[model samples]
Target: MDVCLLYFEDCPNWKVTDRRLVAIAAEHPEVVVRRKRVETMEQAERVGFRGSPTVLVDGADLFASPDSAAGFSCRVYRTADGLEGAPTLEQLRVALGLTQEVTR
Candidate 1:
């Protein structure tokens, strides 16, 4: 599985997401994680960037919201606890279908 993290330079949450992705990588050896920087408006439009820190699983936004518009800005996630800059760890695991036991 290929997981891509899309974010802009100003986004603060991308690093957090990257850290989580690193953890996930350790757990899921078969998955490859990549980071894409959306710099310009045209690039964002071209890539369908919903916002910074958008998690794309095989080029599809995993936590996409119908109300959110595509742009180059910080994205807020409606997590289980509340509004957060990035999705929670559990949320990501669930989205990626990695809820099963992490191989030791």
Candidate 2:
């Protein structure tokens, strides 16, 4: 599975999402994780970034939402706790269908 973390500068949650992806990637080495930065509004539009720190699984947004007009903004994520800047690791695991068990 290919995963890409599309983000922009000044997005604080991007780092946390990056860390979570790193750990998740360890479990699925075959999954390639790429970081795409949206540097401008045009870039954001051309790339169809839902918001900063948009996680794309196999070229599709993990979170299913009606595509917005497309702009540079801070996107809020839906988490177990509530709306958040990023989803929990477990949420990501389920979304990606990755196992939490560590192979010995």
CA lDDT of each candidate?
0.85, 0.81
Write one digit per residue (lDDT tens) for candidate 1, span 66-92: 776788778888765679999878888
Candidate 2 lDDT tens digits, 12-99: 9888889999998888897778999998888877777988788889877867588566777778877767788887788788778785
Task: Write down the lDDT that model 2 would get.
Answer: 0.81
Q: Where does candidate 1 clash, by residue pair?
A: none
Candidate 2 residue spans exceeding 4 A from truth: 99-104
TM-score of candidate 1 relative to the true fold? 0.90
How badly does each model clash, as a count of residue pairs? Answer: 0, 0
TM value for model 2: 0.86
The parts of candidate 1 lying over 4 Å away from their true place are 100-104
Error of 2 at 15 (Å): 0.4
Query: lDDT (0-100) at residue 70 of candidate 1?
Result: 83
